[model samples]
Target chain A: MARAKKPKLAVWKFASCDGCQLSLLDCEDELLAVAANVDIAHFPEATRAVIAGPYDLSLVEGSITTPDDAERIHKIRRRSKRLITIGACATAGGIQALRNFARIDDYINYVYARPEYIDTLAKSTPIHDHVWVDFELRGCPIDRFQLVEVINAFLNERRPNIPRYSQCVECKRSGAVCVMVSRGTLCLGPVTQAGCGNLCPPLGRGCYGCFGPMEAPNTMSLAGWFREKDTSADAVRDLFRTFNAGAAPFRKESEAHEQR
Target chain B: MKPAGSTDPLPAIIDKGGLQVLIDALIGGGFTVIAPRLTDGVIALDTITSVDHLPAGATDEQEAGYYRVHDGGGGRLFDYATTPQGWKRYLYPPEERLWQAKREGAGFAIVEERAPVPRYAFLGVRACDLRAIGILDAVFDHGRSAEPRYVARRDQALIIGVNCTRAGSTCFCTSMGTGPAVGTGADLVLTEFGDDAAPALLVEARSPAGRKVFARLGGRQAAAEDIEAADAAVAKAATMVTRHMATDAAAILKRNLEHREWAKVAQRCLGCANCTLVCPTCFCGSVEDTTDLTGATAARWRRWDSCFTSDFSYIHGGSIRRSGASRYRQWMTHKLSHWWQQFGSSGCVGCGRCITWCPVGIDITEQVRRIKDSEGGPH
Candidate 1:
């Protein structure tokens, strides 16, 4: 006749725009059910309430930018039973990871009024690059339903059903005409992962690789074709250097097309 | 009413106006009429009420990884070869809920999805697509463990075949022995001709249901010359298709599964799975189970899957088809060779959607020819 204690769920932010965290709050209808199921222990964005660890599940957002934040994540990892990296930031070092390509001190001197006050790392890296990540839910801003699915899977002790296939599969499944083939628009749907619900292509815009490179993505083949056709080598390079620019395959691809 | 397998009715000549009468009859008979119309800059199948909804005076140019719509120069309905999206989506949807479970007390109550299936009259069904449907029938309807949803939807469907007067550059239906002129499966078949002069259609009923719809048209019998003109139009379409698939591809592909050409193709292949997704008869699907946050309800969904995905061949350790070469080999070999062993026929209907829709433009016919050309070479 006793109710069991609920699993503690924590949402952590490091170097993100807080958009990924907003996805959870945006689950307005499912929030009630989610609240009932899990203990919202330490979500500073949603509630000032802070419950002590070790937390049952921690949903980490944003990349590890500062050295202090890097050390803080390892502590968070130690305190959490299951650590999931949500959004392109935590999984592949967000758009800010574009800074990873250049000198950090030069960027600091160029942008900051007080360069001496700013404390950061040489490279903006993903959480998994610093510590172990149980699972990664990819997107510029992660799909809320997929985030829910990942949490639900953790609760149910099952593998999450997030797809690792190209966005073209979703386009075909939804019967969306291929923007690239039909209109000669340059699209990254062939190499980008399929968690965005086939977003940009249907609107006559090409996929921007928001969900990062798909599993074993043939980036070279796609880039080669794009460069051979209307797209310039620089354009093709910049195509892979967006939201998930720090992802390994994309990083290698963009570097391949470097003007040097 | 005539029996279901009644003999074929004679072909009748119907003007452009008579085509509208047939559309009305189908709509009146409580069927959702899906026809080819221009949408999103390409010919697509969608619901229509009148014949004007069809893509008249319009045609498309399709090549490997390219498609463009242009003025066909003549006021003829059914001028296009085939849309990238096929009739498969109607019979076998991209995704469907299989069942749902809701917790009551200690146990949950399982509810099987029994949603009412719609009776569809698919207008502008190309010959190759018709054959693709036949292949799907074997996969879903004819099997012992028949898919209930597919069987119900297919049973309540009416096929309105359209003979191709012009072929896309990617099309090779003649090599596949499937198109240019329709054979067998349709309830009614239409051939468009005399676009510059009269703009007439030759309608033939191949089934009893089609005969009933044909009788409703009350059109004049097709003259010998009208039939000749219609035949000539389809014959020209056959000549337009320059691509060819080796007739002994089934044997040749099976023999050369480990050919060096597989690796060569992998270099150009993005492994995007667009080829399989757009393919008419690929027919691979996977199921996903999900539960709500409350844990009170759970549902299972079936969605189209492709071998190009790493997880498609996942077992305990890792995927069987780990390399792009292996996955591409599995798809092509299954379509051209293993399909015959499993279903007594090739899986590909030569619709050429794979060629047109592929981002990298990897042509299946060309790949087959390359493998066949260097058959029994170094593995």
Candidate 2:
């Protein structure tokens, strides 16, 4: 008999809209190619088929927003050989981290009919906050191509080719008219990470930081440009506090905006 | 051989009706030809046949928060300014099917469909619109890893860019260093000098693919005077544009995130998401699944979504931007300030679609001017 395959892939979710995991399914043509290489032991969103682990790779999505989820992730971490967090929710606490700045109880009361029935944590936190993440794929929904690239890298034992630079690199390469300079339009391409491929700029719009902050982002200087363009500090603060609001640099910048 | 920027004129002139024959030739060669047609009170990219279908003698008056039609003196057919829709509908698409899945006996089987090939000829494309397409190509086609879907369409399509003889009030491509004149990235570029001057087209072949399309046209090479006329036409259009935004806006916006004036702009913003929907490059989307009655089969779809939506930023139990002010701030700053950090340039192309399509008519340029004029933040 042929020897059983060793590598097992597991997908887990927490508090999210499921957009990130959908990105895995969005791989469409790439899905079968990926599954052929590895044993998809667990992916509840894609299939009901479950294979028990210790799995070789685990792709985690969403954020830790409930007490139960917080405890459950630990067991997953122990069972997984390599754990990677995917999307804004899992890596940056998601847009739900907005609760960190405001009153969580007010949200509970406003959204839910019976606040008592809903068991939740005070603030949404990233998987990295709880356990070590081998890698973190940024974006509200990680770009499907990048998702494939990450999976391929891990399978081949190599580093992923994800860029750490800002959207500016993409914009210049595409020869886009500088929205801010030419049109005096407000945009976030200068400080946000390059992944969404400068989607907003050519549409005559700005970047919304869906992919989160880049490595050592010069957000302060970019914020200065926003001001010079007549963007208010509060407006700039709000920009930082979006999508990947809980990310460290964005969080710090947003907090500073709130202080003013 | 003419240099890339030589002011040489062309000898041959096609009759106004000859354009139909040209389009027919393209279609005959198995190309899906798309051009601007008057639709629902706006010029949009739609399928067209003869020159009559074109928005002949139509012009547009575009300003911050305003766009209206103007009569184009009954001579030029492709005289209208750009509409709310950009070429993204063809390149990026509003929604796409990433894959399809079906339940197997024990698990699930999935089939990924081949990306659609866009073997179409885009006619009457404006200089600004061409610039916008170039920007998208950078993001979608020429990247270290091109989006397979975008690449398929981009590789197969042909572009026929038109020089703008009229400028809208919101037009600022001249300031942004993009164009009022046609630039590279086009297969064939036409500059209309009206009937008497034999409407000349200064064709530049950027790629072999472009050369093939131009070679098929059978038009003679341009002369010095024809080249000069095209140049004069572009310069005239550039002068007619009324709007102007600061050049150093990125640096200024980057520093003023905490300024209070955002609150003022927020007051006028309705959060209806008109600006984002009409934007050519706003590619943010959401995913959905529709299942049959048995629930065994489902089709997952990617739909256009906006950050302005309340649920867009929702994580577990709540949303990040709870107020109209925060959402507006998020949209504007991302477009102007943070886009540079992410893509290496500002995201906006100065087409003014957002300004015109916005129901509330919130002028982004005006908002920036207000923020810059205020003294609360560090300049």
Candidate 3:
């Protein structure tokens, strides 16, 4: 029997850390197995060998923070069949999305001595905001096991099993006592999505909302409890102003707290 | 005070040696004993073959949204507080494959994924956790579709409940009418007490299996003084718990449907779902069917799901409960009120996992108080 042609997998980056793409490279044990299954098309972080698109699976990292990034994503989307966005930046507009709340121009003027040279957009956005996204893997840096799962699911034409539930579930599974319950520490595990495998809770620290809000998150009730701890409204606002601040639910909640 | 559970057959004195004998009996008879072990700086429930594997000298300090473990310097075994991992993890895992389908020739063949549930003899289960398992049992058993895996795992598992001699700062199982003492839903319940020099356990067997296991250990029959000591320990635990749910929970949650407290909470909530996930009895979940990109093979699996997510209530025409207020209201109301009508008991065992795991320290008792205060409900 003739061997079937392998699907070309391309990884692209935009205006953030290369962590998500590095997550793919970090799959050391599985990298060889993954390479055998698919063609490494245009992962600049891994190799300079670039294969032209019309690729099968395109994994996108980082947020669309620049005007060039906004236009480039559409072209990438057009050339790919299944385009999956990875990490907080590509799925929910990353930490840089804080600009969505404040003025980006002010940041450009303050950071860059030559303010006229800046080519960034007013607001950082996810790939889905500009172009169609087949799937979005939510995380700050993204989970490696999930990255493998997502690729495997897509290659098999199956829906990804990445849960939309909160990190509290993961915390329980991993056997980390509730930092909130045990130490009176503030954690974001309750309403945040599960992907990181209860990382922050085991360390006796709270989840910083790295995976974004879970399904139908009830932030109002949780925030009221936060206020009970003598936390001011500004502190509450800053809490929501995190890795996934531009995500709609988080953004809306932050905006609501801003009024106070 | 309120009808404390009656532990029959009286208790037997099981010193350190007797406990080891009991562990040896379980191990020899094909039971995988699981106990709390200090791993990665946390006291986690992990596999143990010997009594020596149990966490010793370590004590946990727990508060709202916070937990810390410090060495208390020797002797007692079950001296720690609650673990982040619960029995639900073993019985109803975070991820379990349901079935898989593959393309072969003209038609696709499907295969059901099955694995034999292990016989686990759980050591150091707190009263709240034991009650939680009971609540979970009712949920899985009473549902139209019983979780066969949960049923199998639960039925085969042996429970060893540990009475709380010292409560964590966040503990309130006493207030919820759940704990502070080893009561029900276990094969054996042990109350740790006596002088530090002669550390002892007052062991009570709830079932025939428990008695058989206990009898094999060759422990001396407990005297009246041992029972008295156990009672004193329970009484001390009940009074020691400082955290209390001051409000009438059911009444407050039921009446405050559209309270302003919901809005205030939503602002800081972040809807993280930690509370529900940490909760021992929260059994809500969703399934997913997946395959590689080729459309060649497909597999279905179930994972734990929480109502605190935006996608939890999502339908074809967007989300049913879009606002954070509605999601928060749904979770608390369901846990406190809806669970009673659905099952025969409240979903919460008041393990305080939700409060401790909550990154922002969103105390469940505090939220209930707010609702109670806003409506001027009974204290």
Candidate 4:
């Protein structure tokens, strides 16, 4: 469907690092072109200038951590024609979702002086868990190039060219030597979705799975290999329990090792 | 040194020092000299201007899902087996812009990409890689619709093939009928001996361009003993490769379409597309057309793609190969069975790159053998 003459684009935040929103501002040159095509109606990160809703497109960042965020997402979803979630926070509940596995009351008492004053949910959840999300752009602080592509795709009414395969494809394409194979480093590249331009492998380190689990990830198979390499069950559990811990595949995999 | 005009006949012997002379002449001839260099803990093909740039005395031990570089290899430059990357990176790049368009008054003006192609002199190309290049040649340079970008680069490229003295654990070139020795398509071929021997190279000029570069070296004619040593070194490499691919792989794979082994292998396959990306002959690419935010300018780009992805088989309804089992079957079947029908040759060059680079070490050779053994045939 053709959008308005100049679609009103809104950027919304919940509970996040704000790095994913900064990625849009980090678009540097492309941001200017994006502004010319769409009305930046509400982007608190870039500007305080607010244009009232019924926004054509809304770029949502962060997870639903508080009671207010859980209720606020429903109202935002109703006002926007299309909504896309950006980064690990909005897509997989971010690193904060580690609390989902444990008692939040203990954490509140441990950190905050008065536990009675704290107002939060038991579990941090992705935007899709609260409201319908059109698309989810993955990454810890979503890839800026992909952010531009997602916006461009929405503007042109086309599917965004984001790959659902593992990061190994990008690693091999960039001619980066397989760090796991060469150095025996425990890598999440085989199960992590392709994007982030293969940031870690070439630098002699393993992928922390910032982009989250790839489509139909065989996490048990990879964790089995990790165990074969003498990686402790606890270490294997901690590996999957990272930035994309709340992602289903990673969450299920991490929970499997918890009993051990 | 002899003058550049002097004609040196085929089959000459040159010490290790003469290699530097060859590299110098190729660079002076205005060609980007690419050779095997140690980079990122693996032997990679990159631009080198001198002999010292080669991964001398360094050899890598390779197996399924393993690779490690070790020092103290008798100081032989071409001692290493296959490099992590092939010459396809230079000939058919991973990504290239096809064309661009700009918004005009009422219509858009299409602009053709006119980037200059560089003439390359590829040093230390292995037999498997040379065959891989030939396979790519059929796919891109001499196919129904020849790719202009590949043609422009391949036509002007210089190939310097090197005979392997030692094969890696993953190597199966002999079974594929591709190598261990330089066979065809190279302008110049060199067979190197270890330090215990003369520590020299038996060089042969296979083409006129090879002779032109050979003449500049002014090397002595190779003696009969030197040729014998070179032949012995190549023969030893053939013996080094313990792994073998069944010669009738195409027939075996075509017959076992519904083999149970596919599902078993898919469990470990990861469907990561690493095997396809690391493969030299696995030439599949996808085109993406993108526009600036303002929609004022648009460009088309072709980048490497693999069959292992769900998107690769996505049609109007949905992806054809949805399961990992189906995708794995498609990749193997296409590589062995379909490739023979489409191109007159087998797609795999027995380079073992797919096996070596796979994260899970899902061996293609072992997988083929399992399928072959299931029929209870004496393969």
Best by TM-score: 1
- Cα error of candidate 2 at position B150, Å: 1.7
Per-residue alpha-carbon lDDT of candidate 3 for residues B308-364, written as tens digits (9 for 90 to 100): 766678789977877877888899999887778888667778888788767767788
Is 1 or 2 the stronger prediction by lDDT?
Answer: 1
Tens-place lDDT digits, model 3, residues A122-145: 999989999889889989899998
Docking level for model 2: incorrect
DockQ of 3: 0.42
Using lDDT as the measure, what is the rank order of every candidate, best first?
1, 4, 3, 2
Candidate No. with top DockQ? 1
Q: Name the weakest run of 10 consecutive residues (lDDT summed) in model 4 chain B.
A: B1-10
Model 2 TM-score is: 0.58
Evaluated with lDDT, which candidate comes out highest?
A: 1
Cα deviation of B258 in candidate 2 (Å)?
A: 1.3
Locate the minimum summed-lDDT window of 10 residues in model 4 chain A. Answer: A1-10
Predicted structure 4, TM vs. truth = 0.96
TM-score of chain A of 3: 0.96
lDDT of 4 by residue, B1-379 (tens): 1225535464888876798889989999999999999998888999998788888888899988889999855668887788887888899899999999998978999999999999999999899999999999999976579999999999999999999999999999999999998878888898888464337888888778998898888679888777878889999999999899987889999988998899898788788888898899988999988887666788999999989988889889999999999999999988978899999989999999999988778888899988888899465
User: How far in Å is the alpha carbon of B210 misplaced in model 4?
Assistant: 1.2
lDDT of 4 by residue, A134-253 (tens): 999999989999999999988877778898889988898898888888888999999999889789998989989999999868788888888988999999999999999999999999
* Candidate 1 Cα RMSD (Å): 2.5
Query: What's the true lDDT of residue A188 in model 3?
Result: 69
